[model samples]
Target: MFKGLCRLTSVAALVCSTFSTALGAESGKQVYTGTLGKTPIVLEVNADGGGDVGGRYFYQKYRKDLMLSGKKVGQTLVLDEVPLRGDQDAPHPTIRLQPKPDGWSGEWRSPEGKVLKVDLQQANIAPAPAATVPFLTTLRDQSPYEYLRLQGLDLKKGKAETFMGYSLQWWIEPKSETTLFEVVSGYTAAERQRINQQLMGRLWQEVAGKFDCEASAGETFYAQTVEPLWMGPSTISVSIATEYSCGGAYTDENDMPLNLDVKTGKTLTLEDVLWLGQGKPLHYEREYNDATPSSESYDAYSDYRTKTLAPWLVQQLSALYPDEMKTTTEREDGCIYGDEQPWTYPSWYFTKSGIKLVPSFPHISSMCRDTAFSVLPYNLIQQHPGSAALQLP
Candidate 1:
């Protein structure tokens, strides 16, 4: 994605230069970052032939991207804002500014009849580039099910930008029921379209909600999906990773794993694939609801983590990376060498050869970068006590 942005920057620069030289016009694209009133903003101006201007202006406080269009007269440029969703009755906002060698200084008129002064410095940044290639593509009518497609969204305000991105490279199934589609009935073309729209709509709303809140708080939020791992004949797993900053000293990173059963179109929990001791069956919904983390279901997870999963993981890690464990223990005092708090359960995904575990940042060590990952070979897991329940041959 960075490479694509770099390419766009170069192309835009070339086009601007060509217009300036050939047409003898003030034609170029410049990005400015600063604040409008109390809110941060990112404004882009693209001036073309005959002083025709158009670009995008973003409001960080509201996660709104307003279209800019106007004309340059003499040494000053005047641009008006078009709302993201057009409403005919809303008052149109306008900006009048003069270009300086270092940046732009302007006056802004709000839709609510308020006027404010704006001073901005040229932001040495690249615009969020569009996704040109699909992560995976399905031919028309080639398979019984449509391939999972990748999508990207960007919201920029001043120097801050939030990107919601997904990758479909791990979608290798030729034809099978997906968790997103199983809730709806029928597989006709129209039904498939409806299912796809609903699935994508939900994802968009989730990201947009976060973006809107963070914008007002003077922060940025980004979420993306990692490459999926196929666990077995019926299971597919992927991790949704998120980074957020609410004008804090540091950003927070989190990971949520989704282990879906392709056959049943439901998520597979620990109880589904492994026995959880003698008791009534336990089932966990795939979706993670922030509002319900304090509920009974979470308590059940906490118990399972402390008593069963953590111990088993320690044994496996000891056998896999003994030297690293020994060194870590020797470095810290009062930190029980091998017994680290296992609150952040490792998100696991299965491959043909083994099961890969990805623990969120700060789970294993405070300084670990990104996420700590390890793979337990299929043979090794099969040797464990409850391997028979996994249904792997």
Candidate 2:
């Protein structure tokens, strides 16, 4: 399924590139290059074309041999798409580094294949080029989507601007109604709303049944935005601003469901901040609820073994005397039942399938006269020795 979709998406790319390139020009580069730790890694555009992605060497620290394929549309460097070996989803295009008489320069393409013209001819030529200023690249698609409206400024083709003496990049772009008939077909908005309300009511009932609910309410709103970033190989830097609002929340005091502020806004709550501080914690992991589940309820392994495991046994017993194996059917209550049982000595027989057991008694039956046949040894082994048992009875 994924393979088919990927193929379809790739084919779709040919026609989609035009609008995507224009819309894409607004967002910067998706793929990027930088360091993982101390080791330098060339991060490039992935097939999904979202942002900077690392290759196998990103982990092993193997710098790819930057082989120049030639120029694209003149002085523009053309990079070869190297088939990377490692855990990457697909191979990516290499960063084409074009060296002039003075310094190295190149153009970087975002994941979407929209190229960002870059030049570092005048910067200080040290061992390697440093990422002077980052740009607002592309807004990544979280999932498969349509109507991708990338919100931001625009740039012209064949035109160039400088940031810390570098150019900015660019790129671009449920329902149900049915009912049990109507109840199942929720085909209209009203029907869907009714269904959703009923569902939420039932869910709340179940939750309230399990635990006391101090409040109950919900709100719905829509939001979108474009965030900027400075993504190198290993290190990632970015800024985000979102527009959103809470629909509503239910509380016991409001018999008339009070609606929360349904308005859009933005808050920069310290997500894009990272520090290599002194004596500070290397990693400060955080979780939402702000509390941890207690471990005291857990028992030791030995306790579980004695209480839930030890003394449990399974055994198979040989035929008590001898038995007759038969397949028979009967009408029980109203259902027709099939039986596979062994007829034993005296007059009783039993059959079982999985967890069900059956008891039956046949009056002599047609086998009484020929019961003396000597198939006893096989029957004893197979638990079908009714012939041998009938001889005694």
Candidate 3:
């Protein structure tokens, strides 16, 4: 696999430009299947009239987007690579191709003067196909998909196992150690498919994100552990902890919990399970990749999470689990998970008995966040449940 997405050089004149190739913009774009020398690629060139040419392409093997731009020079279309944000050293390649009876044929030349033969033929791509689109095609389908496919995403299914009476299949990106679990049995085929889509889409992001990081900084050291927290009848949940270092001064670590409603294939949020806000529950992130949440909406959500829910959650947990809530120097310099400060906006997942919440802490107290001690009983979650019609076990 390619180490990273190529970037633009210091030249500002040859920079990437903005153009929408969204859901219904296929008319404006033309897809091509060809090769830049021996390597295969799927190129998208602008089809809207005039000599001005632009679009993007991905290596058939890499499945990552590399932008292109330029205009027609007589019979030949001359295009320059539009470098994205990445490493300092970019080849800044250029392509010169002339339209032939079948398609287009040209030469790909790099800044270093290395040249290779370029050949291309239009590809039939559908944003919305009648049948199940191949995973490779969906990599750049540009459809209103349930999940956003990132550049350099290579999804591979690994390990088949059983957890809590649920048949599990793991989709893994070995390089980054990114793992996503798919429920293989239990529900109808349609329901299982919907769930698999969600899992695979997320897997794409994790893998692509790693490739992106490596491309920008070169050879990132990434490791992830997917902990299955729940595989109950009503909910499927997992917690992912990632630690990465991409030529940085220090490694960075973060954790996220994915909780999906087993029935509807919807991601369940903290507010969805337990909310004490007088106003409506907050949307922490977009439900789908295509959504554009305004800054104002995000600000309101931040306020609600910090001001409203954080304190209320602490109060509730404190009242319920007073012993666990008590802070002592014994635990990671007194960085307790039940501490009101850290528990304010925790990443949580569902469990058979209760809700397992892990606190967020400063780098100095990261160890405290590792141990999940603040668990809220299912009884409370059922009391102030949000809009989702969930059956609490």
Candidate 4:
């Protein structure tokens, strides 16, 4: 069920107005912190039954902005956005919470309501996420796309830098001299290699070009630290601090794109690169055995619709001919590969299923969409007079 996706799923800012020491702690190894702001594009999920299911993604060039935070360590965050019908606008709740020694307890209320409630603690506070290299600039600034495969990042120098008026440290300082560092001494050779190889990069050229970089610092560095304090079985405490510019591209609410041309047929752009992701894989083992008690089955093909079918078909094609298919990872590689996934429907499936046209990623409604699409392409080619049946193991 969609709820299972929620189960699989699942920060702060300095400010102009500093809070009293009681509300804000700035000294003595204050709990590490992080903040994610101005996530240019808004993600609207329908929350049908699982992750990204039955959701219509409207890539608003510029409309609403997203931000959140929690106090203390080991807290849980539940963000719910229910799309209302027929002029009825649903209210969304932005909750801040931390675990109390007594039990799970935190205050929650809608932005439009005064009816606040204190609920029992169901989970612990989640730690901040890892700080990684910004994708676009990394790709553009790095070596020839052909040689830039994903690999471990070596922290040559580690230190801190004050960015955007905030005094922040660099967890994995780049190999440059101007950076800072505090090497934790206590590990074997294997441990040292593991620490040295901790690297993260993003694919952002498309998004960055669509929206300009907000700063002229040439390049800014950030840091992150994670501590394993259980918020839930998989949850932990995370503290992060990074530099972000307030002057980058902003899309007007009306400027968002309702459609996406993901397949090879359409023109490739930085926007596509920004949110590109491999179609979700239906992990048979996880879905059937490891999923939560209330989890739904992972079926690629059952009921069929173009929306439900396209991504599934593409995923199958990807599995069948992985080296040739376009994936977010490969796209980030920036190499000249063969045809990309066309935004348009391949001819064979449409005729058999008797459907016309399909929406892009966020518009998908069900697993069936992916499943139907997966088999349809191969099925079409197989039916061609002398063609042999395509095999998928």
TM-score quality measure for candidate 4: 0.18
lDDT of 4 by residue, 122-220 (tens): 111222123322231232122111111111112343345443232333433232111222113333344322222221121122122222222121332
Worst 10 residues of 2 by lDDT: 173-182
Best by lDDT: 3
Best by TM-score: 3
Measured on C-alpha atoms, candidate 1 has an lDDT of 0.47
**How badly does each model clash, as a count of residue pairs?**
2, 34, 1, 44
Per lDDT, what order, best first? 3, 1, 4, 2
- Candidate 4 Cα outliers beyond 4 Å, as residue runs: 1-183, 199-238, 241-243, 249-393
Model 2, global lDDT: 0.23
Mind giving the per-residue lDDT tens digits that candidate 2 earns over 1-393?
Answer: 111112122222322322332222223322232333244332322222332222221211222222122234344335554432333445455555565653335655546786654443211111111111001010122201011111111112222323222233322110011010011231344533333232222222222221112111223232222222221111111222122223233211101111111011011111111111223212212221123333432333223223322211000111321222222332223211122122111111111111011222232232231222112232222332211111111
- TM-score per candidate, in order? 0.44, 0.16, 0.70, 0.18
lDDT of each: 0.47, 0.23, 0.67, 0.26
Q: Which residues of candidate 2, in runs, are more than 4 Å off?
A: 1-162, 174-219, 227-236, 249-280, 284-393
Any residue pairs clashing in model 1, and if so which?
A: 41-158, 42-158
Order candidates by TM-score, high to low. 3, 1, 4, 2
Among all windows of 10 consecutive residues in model 1, the one with the lowest summed lDDT is 139-148
